[model samples]
Target: MTQATNDQFLLAARPVGMPKDSDWQRATPALAELADGEVRVKILYISLDPAMRGWMNDARSYVRPVAIGEVMRAGGVGVVVESKSPKFAVGAHVMGVMGVQRYWQGPAEDKGAMLAQVDPAIAPLPAWLNALGMPGMTAYFGLIEVGQPKAGETVVVSGAAGAVGMTVGQVAKHLGCRVVGIAGGEDKCRFVVEELGFDACIDYKAGPVHAGLKQHCPQGVDVYFDNVGGEILDAVLTRINMKARIVICGAISQYNATEAVKGPANYLALLVNRARMEGMLVTDYAARYPEGVATLARWMKEGSFKNREHIVEGFETFPSTLNMLFKGENLGKLVLKVADA
Candidate 1:
């Protein structure tokens, strides 16, 4: 056994709109030794999500903001190399909010509370943290608890081809709802419908979303799973059926707004239709995560749930890989490979 050190990506500055290269700093330091009830892990993959943008700002949120100069907060998969804990043995593969680094040192209690041992047989290590992970849970609870879709109803999801939105549509279809997705491009729209099993997919970049929705969802939307708010939210609002439910998941469209978030101009439709719209934080359903994970894993095994990942090659690409979310360059869950182990 020998001592080792690692490199980490640290937050340097908060961005006003879109994050830039200067907003991040890379630093190397000696890895700390494992203490009592602690373990040292070699991080393998880091999850890149839209919510990471909100974490960069200094403001009140469901979770604390990532402080300046700290290693940027992220979820990742890792292999334990050293363990002084009874629960986790060396060579174990686990997933947690491990930050953007090549190595992690934390108490076994901390890992036990926030992390889970991964089964590579269920799906790949990265897929568990992506499709079967937080994004999957977000889609599951957001639709079931918040949107409340019913059979024969029309369900619409914005940001349709992305991680959460894509999962939402697929789940809706599985529950016997007619699913329509709103994505940015034709290729993504094709993947959403042809690959992910949505009934229809609208290309927001190609034409008017309002018209597209009208064409696909002529019967009116029963459950609206909104992942990209702003104009698309307003457009969906106009088409809600009476007693429709709107699940306010993530609003990737407004995440980087330099200006104040604008309210939906068509909210009056909610009043007229007596529809309900509510925001949700996945952590709010923490107690029921195992239930969700069990169902998701079953779906994955049965070939009902599809897990997609767009993985970058190295830890050094963390900052740039994150920007891909805002640019709509990724087709599925985005992950950064930090190390080989």
Candidate 2:
């Protein structure tokens, strides 16, 4: 193959609030020759996630901060355009932390690379970034392992229209639980209930979450999957039944907050209810990804599960497109299309 160029977004500066264009710098660098056990992947679709906002802060977290001038950390699906590794063929499609770049050239075994081949035949390329990727894995393990909802119980998910939240609610329904979702708009709430088959969806933008929870969950909540933290989590806390399980999956509401993150004030409710609130990271269940993917895939094949993705065309829209998440502009999974597969 001929020499290639890689266009990328680098972390220029950390943001105090919501990220802006000034926080990122774009560059087109010439790709280096692949070494032994190395591969060059042409990124197709980049997964725009709420966790990315936390990754930008110059603070301690599960993953290291994206250093200045380094490619912005992002998970994406791509095709191996060039390869020197026997594990990957040049035409194979793959997914990993390929960064906010047009091309990714690195060692196949690089810890930072986290490369894995994905088959478009199993699901659409964009679906891999949404329901079948990290978000799906998060929903599966967080709900199943942490929340542990049984049949006849009630499961409530905040950010219910989002990638992870949508999956959580649907999976809970499949397990014979009553699923309710809390989202920002009537359209989103309608999508979760009408399109996604959620038992009910509370439009937090329309009214108070506490009231919605009280009305829909008269029996109280047996399991709560929290994607947006702050008031929603607090509201859910007040309605939790005895031995309730709360899975803290994310805090998208607090991701772009200028002030320190607000925690739930209803902590005493947990004590009074004998409930447990636990946090989960999808990476911890990396070893069992195949298991999770297979189960989610089966549901999709059976038409019992559905995935919705709001894809934005153009790599240039990275900054603004990502802001769509915090603003609740996108209906489902927010994805950035870099190139066609």
Candidate 3:
């Protein structure tokens, strides 16, 4: 097969506050020839996650910052167009941290970043990277490992309609825990309770979150899976039950903060309740991803799990699609369709 150059979104400058169009540079570069054990893939759907914003800044974090002039970092689903790897064949659909680009070339040995073949029959390409993908694993491990909700316990989740939060709520419900969701709007709150099977939902935008939490979780919260940190976190911290567990997931509220991150003032509740608060990185549970995916996919097929995708039409919509997370405009897992299947 003939190799052709591809266009990619490059980081032109570090972003201050929220990123702007001027911070990115769109450039075309000649595709490198496929080397031994390497494969070339044509990217189809790119995952637009809140964590992508944190990755743009050169800060101390779980992952390295995207280098200046490099392709904007992203987790994407793609189809192999060229292959020298024995494990992967041409036409195979795969998912990986392939960045925001049309094509990718990498070695099979580099499993850390190289694309992994995805079974499109089990779930759609986009779902593999969203529901049954990184976000799904995050919700699973974060709740089970960090939150440790016992059956009949009250599980409260922030960012309830989002990819991770949605899954966390549903999984907790399936485990016999009474789930309470906190979302940005009444519509999202209704969807979380009615569709995702949460026992109750609170619209953080409608009124006081602390009151809503009190109304829904009369028994008090046993597990708090926090996604949006800030005021909501502070409110939840005050409602923790004795020996409650708090799972510190992504803090979307503070991601674009120009000011210093504000810690919850109600954190003393942990000491009073003998509770534990732990932050989790999903990558730490990478060894058990297949196990999590299998269980999630089975639940999906059995009608116990639901997966939602907020798909943007084109690659050009990437920038605006990313901003939707901060604005709470996206309903579920946000994805940009870079190419047709």
lDDT ranking, best first: 2, 3, 1
Clashing pairs in 2: none
Candidate 1 structure quality by residue, lDDT tens digits, 1-341: 63577788899999989999999998898887778998887889888999999999999998889999998888988888899998789989888888888887889779333867887877789887776789989999999999889999999999888889888988898899999999999889999988889999999999989999899999999999999889999999999999999999878989989999978999999999999999998988878888988888888889988888888897777778899999899988888887776
The positional error of residue 83 in candidate 1, measured at the CA in angstroms, is 0.5
Per-residue error at 268 for model 2, in Å?
A: 1.0
Off by over 4 Å in 1: 1-3, 111-113
Q: Least lDDT summed over 10 consecutive residues: which range in candidate 2? A: 1-10
Candidate 2 local Cα displacement, residue 172, angstroms: 0.4
Q: What is the C-alpha RMSD of each candidate to the true structure, in Å?
A: 1.3, 0.9, 1.1
lDDT of each: 0.88, 0.93, 0.90
Over the stretch 1-341, how does candidate 2's per-residue lDDT look in tens digits? 65477899999999889898999999999888889999999999999999999999999999999898889999999999989999899899999999999999889887987999898889999999988999999999999999999999999999999999999999999999999999998899999999999999999999999999999998999999999999999989989999999999899999988987998999889999999999999999999999999998999999999999999999999999999999999999999999987
TM-score of each: 0.97, 0.98, 0.98
Give residue 214's lDDT in candidate 3 (0 to 100).
Answer: 92
Instruction: Tell me model 3's lDDT, rounded to 2 decimals.
Output: 0.90
Q: Sorted by TM-score, highest first, which candidate order results?
A: 2, 3, 1
Better of 1 and 2 by TM-score: 2
Best by lDDT: 2
Model 1: residue 60 alpha-carbon error in angstroms: 0.8
